[model samples]
Target: MTILGFSPGEWFLLVQHELLLFAAFFFLIGAIDELAVDFSWLWLKATGRAGAPPLDSAITQKDRLSGDAAILIPTWEEEQVIEQTVSHMLKVWPQRELRIYVGCYPNDPATMSAAMAAAAGDTRVRIVIHDKQGPTTKADCLNRLYRALCEDESRQGRSAQIVVLHDAEDLVDPAALPLLDEALHCADFVQLPVVPLPQSGSHWIAGHYCEEFAESHGKAMVVRDAVGAALPAAGVGCAIARPILRDLAKTNANAAPFDADALTEDYELGLKVAEMGGQSRFLRLRDGDGRLIATRSYFPATLDAAVRQKTRWLHGIAFQGWEHMGWGTTTGDAWMRLRDRRGPIGALLLAIAYLLLALAGLTFTLEFVGVLPAIELSGGLKLLLWINLAMLLWRAAWRFGFTRSIYGWKQGVMAVLRIPVANIIAIMAARRAITAYLRSFAGVVPTWDKTAHDRHPSSFPSALDAELRFAPLEAKR
Candidate 1:
């Protein structure tokens, strides 16, 4: 607590070093596991022994069945893209077998109007309005959609085999339907890769999403699938088995499969399904044309918007997840959960590391001018610092490889350069997540912290978006 003959700046770095080393130990454990997964997958792919699910039934089947599944979209103040989102789904999904259930609130007439307009006489689109007022939570809205799906099943005397989840800004892949149909044969929960479109304007804010997701979907998720853990839903590009959805709903007191109070209900659902002995999968499959079938969309473009969205994600992952989902019995599950819930602590470490770097700079300047004694590091501390630095470089290299594979070399290199930016965002997001979590715990009442959306860029010339725009109209006519 007290040190003699040490200047204030020296004291700062000395204390910072201890904190950094403490946090680094935990980070090191995670990095080791992550690297193991990455290396294992590389070996598997090299040997051509990747975990490819069987395709016997799916390949032989000729027609994609519509009644086998339904797509669920929840909207609140999504007037900007609700119609297009619905129309795009209608355009891409199998018309005969798939039914879409869009959830809305009675108070938000604009979104309802947009959703209906997009539906535009298509019998496949069913709009389910929540009984409550607007913007309760995304999970609350999904609960409404689940109830509506049940009612529809009763009305039509038919049951859907799968229920797909998506958001209002998605550009769904037409080829994805058959894959989902095939995946559901053996999986109770299926999650696909999310590919975030580039933002020409917000390179530091929105474009960071591309880098983060590139690493997560490409490497981290592959590890999860390989390890056979419950796959966390990206909240988009995921499908749930209808019977399992009903089972989850029945267990809940309100009969809502999604937890209204959970900030990240989609994520919670994955763990719940896993607890029930269900199979959850995250797969990367290609179409016949060799294109990766993925869900495409844009993340929030502004700094504030990006922070707000990440704040929600960290809150759900670190705070809410701990309170809801208990640490699992297995070693792998505990390790994975520790990785999930380390956000706030990890941000604290990064903040300390940055502060020490700043102090190191100031110390060097002052000592060079003979205003302060030169700061010296012990031999043992120097070795520890060297190890930590090496670890950091390894982490950065892994991220770069994953990002480069997805976004090409330029973005990949930039992603490595953007490590500092990602750290800063994590620090800001963790602070915000803690504030929001404390407020909710203090009985502030958790409501939906809505993230604003932007339509997919028209100038980018997406054949899929163009088809979503015109094909549904033609089909309706």
Candidate 2:
């Protein structure tokens, strides 16, 4: 029967019952999924397998070179922060052991000049100009760098042992190279954790990333390791063995290690390596002073920019991935893929839950004022409702704990408070991602769609002293 024909009492009962069933299905599944991740994290910790291999002495371990490593930094219009990033990175690491290959378009002289100025006569730094025009896909730019490395290798008669990837705004740790080098001895691909510095101007927007990465890098990735799922690279703070890159290039006839057509080439590359029977590791380690070994950078600080960035990720990972990567062979592989593709449905469920909560409040307020009949939930329904509430509390506790582990107690508390804010961003991002994906089929293609960056000024090395330091400042007005 239609709600219009049913009595108010019946209508209220029907709506409440249906909503309860919806909650019982969706949130219960989400809670269970998180429950597994929580348990896996506990197992990793209890067994002492959560930590990285402790070096004999981090600070005292002399400048032992790890052969040769190539660091690839791709830029389109990254003129503002390129100089500082390149300069600081070189100063922080052993210049003789590192070769920084910067990719830029010939049309953009600003970034080219900035990169050249940043290198400042350092023979270790090289700028590779792309043949195409400006703002092509980041993958396209990266491909150019890979080709340059190939030609350089042929000319020099020596190949880099490891290849690393970074975005323009990333601030590398002094220990990141050595650690990545150490980890690569055991695995083909190694991804370190990624930390997004806070922005005061858009706390909700930027802070949400802080909490998200904290939990993902802290807990979810650990679970991924426990289960034999493919390790997805975070685009930065990750390194791959040089030979593996060559194997990946074979798929494209020696053109490039990175896929030029993919939206998230980094994510795809990891999965591709796994498909080729390669082992991957998600390294979550700490430095000598108890600092988490990670790549530090600023995420998009404005709501619109944050949403735009997330939209591209959702389109690439969740939507396009399903079409391109396909279902895997094993149960664990399919399970991980399911989790990867859950973004859109998860956001939709959150929207529905919020709508129902608002409606419930309005209905109860009307009933209390005697404008409508009294409403009530049955015993079974009340029990389910209470269980969901308890699960919310449980999830919030973990979220706070994970955030606290990376950031401090202050940011952890904010993580709990910012759940609603994250949901809003996810909902908006999903909608935009779906639109972008659909538009691609209508003869409109997705290009670089890069997020404009606001690199943390303090994160760069000081002009006064090249000694690298973290100098996060409050967002300006």
Candidate 3:
């Protein structure tokens, strides 16, 4: 029918169809988000009722020292923070039982020098230069270190029961190593929550990091454990059992334990572990002072760093999800596969939604100016708007309740308001990442997008007051 001659019913039908499709897409995204939130809530409730479990109770003291632990930090041009990272490790961990591996590239003389200086007078810290012949990613460096460790096993004669990955800027909590060792006794892999160091340059970046960590490591991971679903490992603060590492090495020899080709090796490793039928757990480590140990790790303190980091992550997650659709095939469950795909696909949909919203606004304006025909809003349209608004309110309330403190409440409110813009940026980042991945799939390797850290150094106090006012008080020492 011609636009001007179309009957009212026909116009309504077309508008209704468009609205219905949009509503369906919105509802799907909301449902997945809410499900994740609900799972987190249930986990928090259960843990509260059960009381805080003893960190050390998870493993025996004998097991802690029975096998050696390797702390691997992958560094690339991070000379400034490398020393601090190593110093913090030595301060917190007992050097006798734990060996540290600092992976560096031969070209990075400054970082190599700093690493050498950090290792001086400490035999436990070993430096490995990645002088390999090809394209390098963090995963490639990790694989090289793993091979080196395997090769020197005869001389060291250490079992290397647990392998932990930390970034160069991480000021690891003193109790983290012990807690990880304990957690690993029962689970094949363990992940610890990382709180970004507060920086003044951009509150958004810090807030984003905080909210992401809180939900994923704090609440969502607990939920994952309760439901027996596999948990994705955060790149830093993750530990793997020696046997699992060996198996991973054996299975993906050519690629490396952390795939150099993959954008995010940590996440890919987590998926691989799930595929291998190994269980992974996350531990929220608290120190002797009855306070949650918040490590001082640099966030993107500058716009350039923020963009680079986000872009890299966006590309990595999308690439792996799209290219290796059957990585988590052991489960073979249709629902699980869909859930796994949600991260990348959801990101893509979010981006599309923004573009559609803009188009709709422009169309409405044209209709008002007599350039386009007006479309009637039908019952479906009304229902869809109402549903979307309700979901938004529910999510906001859930976040507020979970983060109940005054500062937390303020941050939560601000984050809710910024959701639209933040999501738009995320979508753009994801698209760029996907494009790069497609190119890589066709044999074009992307270089490492190294995020610059804050040069203005800060220190993490060796002692935090035993009482943390914001979070629940920890058990007395």
Candidate 4:
């Protein structure tokens, strides 16, 4: 009847009280943090500062052609989707000075072949083969592409004014290129919203991406930009000024502007630019027909794949990010960085909360059977519980609103239902991330844990068709 000098009933009561108190405390803290961001966004929206910028209807192609823009697409084993991505990009973006640089590992001959076939002797596409073998970090591949860009500039005696980072799986908006170019005239770094396309059979797994990006890019990013916090780049749909990149590279002995060793190079790039007094903007724009000028792509569709991708992100952004990039000097910058690195802590809180839910159900069943006494809740704990409930509703409302604004009402309902799915994935990813981060101290070099994509946005007949309508006749591959 006794274990560790306590009766089973007493142990149950002790655990119930302790777990409830722990979860309630942390949940309240997290709720407060989230509420701050929410209120800031609401204030921005109320003041008309959060609306999308209007498109310049009369801006000619000549106006868009102020300078060349280099598009960098890095690959390892992306043969399946690289061709479609390249073809679609060439078709949609009509800037004559635009050059598409696809970095391929020399060992990945199949992807190289696919990229070349997509190019089909088009001078705009240049495939840069990495000197190293396959499976390097994506940032390393991107550095190779940057080197190629520089060599080309040296040969042609003309430099690209801005460098755009994208993945081989992305279906870029036709308006995105010129818009990025236009924004770069004032801002050092520009990021457009990323619209995650819903997959057919993987709604619960992949659809969470749509919900999260909608809320984060829609609300959180707007507030961050408004409050002078550093804007983290989404990688794809982001452009950086050539001058800033050159300045960044010069700091590192002119080897590479990006932290090739870092897992989330894009995220760091924007922050690095901001650290050096460069301006960063999350530019959301709409066309004449009111379509969001954003990058569209399919995320990981399976639970395992989703967890893997998220694991890399958490490892990079939370663990390694905290290790490499310390706290910011200013209040706003530090607050944003804290939010960025709270993934592991948040996951732990979520795990405990779920466990408490199951335990509460068991406690009720035990009390009904007269096996355990009814536990009295403290007034403070009760107050925390009610506050947490209200906060949960507030969070859910925002999630629903954001998803509805993007994917319509049906998806918004699904977004609320998919909260548990996202939480489970986050917990799993956090565990994996912590394990991987610990292994780094043992000198285990991190490689590109790239996601596999079999489908491209171009595979969908109607996807990006409106954007493709602007393609030149000769761009049809």
TM-score order of candidates, top first: 4, 2, 1, 3
Candidate 2 local distance difference test against the native = 0.81
- Candidate 3 lDDT, tens digit per residue, 1-477? 558887654564466457557655666575766676576557677668212343453332332354688888888888888887787688667647788998888778888899888877898899988876323787777888887778668676657888988888787766777777767888899887766543445566555554555555556566565556666677788889988888887776483576777767887787678778898876665554445544546577554556567778767665565465354443333344445455556666675566557767767777789766766666766676677767767766665554443124555665566566556556666666667777875989766677755442235342233225442111111
Q: Write the per-residue lDDT of candidate 4 for residues 68-101, one digit (tens) a residue.
A: 8999999989999999999998887877889999
Better of 1 and 3 by TM-score: 1
TM-score of 4: 0.95
What are the RMSD figures for all models against the true structure?
Answer: 4.7, 3.2, 4.7, 3.8
| Alpha-carbon TM-score of each model against the true structure | 0.91, 0.92, 0.84, 0.95
| 94 Cα displacement, candidate 2 (Å) | 1.7
Clashes of 3: 0
Model 4: residues with Cα > 4 Å off, grouped in runs: 1-5, 60-64, 465-477
Model 1, range 78-176, lDDT digits (tens) per residue? 988888878877866645787888888889999899999998999889989899998999998888888888888899898999999998888787667
- Candidate 2 structure quality by residue, lDDT tens digits, 78-179: 888898889888887864878999999989899999999999999889999999997788888888999999999999999999999999988777778888
Candidate 4 at residue 304, lDDT?
97
Best by TM-score: 4
Q: Give the true-structure RMSD of model 1.
A: 4.7
lDDT (Cα atoms) of all candidates against the true structure? 0.78, 0.81, 0.66, 0.87
Q: Which is better, 1 or 2, measured by TM-score?
A: 2
